[model samples]
Target: MTSDGDDTTVLSTEEGWQTIQATIHDARGAMYTAGSTAILLMWAGIISIAYLAQYAISTFASDFAEQYPWFPGPLWAALTLPGVIGSMTIGHRAGRSLSTGAAMQSVGIRVFLYWMAVVTAAGLLPGAAGLWNETRAETIPYVLVGVIALGHVLFGILHRPVIAVFGLGYAVSFYVPHYIFEGIAPAVSGIAMLALLAATFVWVHRTGEW
Candidate 1:
């Protein structure tokens, strides 16, 4: 039913599609598996501990600080230092082991850099907010939730649907509480994020997905 030209065009299109699909498969397969998962879990654990420690200091340290003047600063450094060192080590190892095509490697490195930027911005927001006022400080949690949701959506578009769906759920879980009660948003968001990361670690570990 088709002419020679039409058949040729169809064949070319199919070949193009096949090439794209193959690249996608290879890219996914090349992602760091156990290494990425371990890094994620370690970071999640560290963040969780830091958040809990911060909460404890804010809520209870007033009384304890008199008796233990050196506690808060030392504790925060202890919690944060290991995470920094571990993440760098794991990321270096993963980079060394990566066997993806140049294009995929470039994409992965950009994504990693973007995330690092996000983290740096998130870290600075609190200090910036302090310079403004308490109300501005309160918005940090909401901004972080939005950023996380957006990050997930970007991942979905670029990588996987599962991450996108998880991001949607994460955004919802934290945002809903803000509408209900603002007082608990930071704590709730931090806890929820850590829980989601924990669950994601388990899922990726079981599935061997990145």
Candidate 2:
């Protein structure tokens, strides 16, 4: 009878541990979903505004562009700076709330560093390949779009399948505008991305699948 009781106690303890582990797993998943939602929404707003501003500058502010000669580059950096800060802030807070907080923080840092490397490589490739001429300048935006889309796809494959879907959608939106409506490609792509991001945000909230 004592041996049987001991066996029962061991099973109960094991079950309790499993339950605790499941709870932690669920909490971490929730935190990740919430953080990703906020980050995606933030980027949606930033990208939309940045693209619109680029269109306005290129179309209506030629004088300013000529005066600066480096108008959009600085503008984009300025616009995205907030998103970078916000992402780090969100990740930090999310990490603090989880049992695996340190590991979560490490993952966030690694992800940020990965993106930094990707963007740096993209920026350097044209120069390294001797393709940084005036004509090639026109393709820079398209190249950036491709790079961003690729990043999204890769990130999604690694972390979230839905993000991969959004990435493909984003690429298609930009490509359609560029090919079919060259005159307003930037504006159209910006609006389309905004809509897509917004829709994804809504779906995630509604389904609670993130």
Candidate 3:
């Protein structure tokens, strides 16, 4: 009877440890989700605004574009800088709330490096192959959107299905507009992305999955 009791106590202790670990895992996931969701929403707004602005400039400010052919590059850099800073801030705050904050931050840094590598490859490979030029400048937006969509899809496949759906929505938004309403593709894609992101925000809150 004493041996059986000892065995039961050991089993209970193991179960308790397992439960504690699961709770910690869930908490980490929730924190990461909260940080990531905010980052995604912020980027969605920034990117959509950039797209809309591009459309407006190209359509209503032809003189400006002609006078300053380099304006778009500067504009994008200006707009993107804030998002980058904001993302880092959000991630840092989220990390601080976790017990393993340093480790979590390290992981985040590694993930960021992975994305940088992906973006670098995307740019370098095309440039090296002489696939990008002034003649195909208009395709730059499509390529950027494609890269973002692909990243989202891969992220979803590795982490969550919902993200993959967002990726699909982004692809469809741009592609459908490109083929069917080429003149307004930028506007349509921007609006679609904003709408999709808004819906995702609502869904996450309602489901409490994040």
Candidate 4:
């Protein structure tokens, strides 16, 4: 006893739900794409800055250590400051562009804050020790590797298994450079970390999975 109008209404309702579902699917994909692209670009920028700074130091500051022993500290700050700012800006814009769930974004923000706190504590420990003693600066890079590895593990907990596996691999691979290049362990560790991050970013870009 159903009329034609009732059949038409049912079809329209089904079509509406399908459209909504499709839109949600597309939005999720967009969010993922944006995140991957942002991380890729941000890490690439950091890598470029590191290499470029090394070039500048070697070319222009060959005798800097003799005259100004504190030169490397400022140089490192110069190199890191931009990378940090640029990465945050890139991530913010990418996340803003896609209409993702607010609850999910809040969770991500909280996790990121926790990661930052952990890393900050790691960095501050060496800094405090350095203030107390003279030779502690040399340990900063090695400590950073540990901190970064921990952050990646945190990401795996909050995000996925792949990052956790990468974290484990990185933690293991990090010690090689420290032991091999004792005099320049920090620089070597930085370069090695940049390479690993670049490789990870490339894989993410190619697969579109994080």
C-alpha RMSD between model 2 and the true structure: 4.8
Q: Which candidate number would show the highest TM-score if scored against the true structure?
A: 3
User: Model 2, 152: alpha-carbon shift in Å?
Assistant: 1.0
Which parts of model 3 have CA positions greater than 4 angstroms off?
1-34, 111-134
In the range 28-54, model 3's lDDT, one tens digit per residue, is 555445455555556657766877787
Could you tell me the lDDT of residue 125 within candidate 1? 61
lDDT of 2 by residue, 78-172 (tens): 98788778877765565554445577666555545555555556556655755555345445566766776777788778667887888799789
Better of 3 and 4 by TM-score: 3
Candidate 4 runs further than 4 Å off = 1-62, 100-115, 131-134, 180-191
TM-score against truth, every candidate: 0.61, 0.74, 0.77, 0.61
Residue lDDT tens for model 4, 1-210:
346657533446777899999998776544544443344335334533554464456546868644654554576567666655654555555566554667434433443344446546655766775732323433454565577667667656554666677677667666776678765654565566667767877887798673
Query: Which parts of model 1 have CA positions greater than 4 angstroms off?
Result: 1-21, 28-46, 64-84, 100-111, 126-139, 181-189
For every model in order, what is the number of clashing pairs? 0, 0, 0, 0
Pull out the clashing pairs in model 3.
none
Top candidate, metric lDDT: 2
Clashing pairs for model 1 are: none
lDDT of 4: 0.57
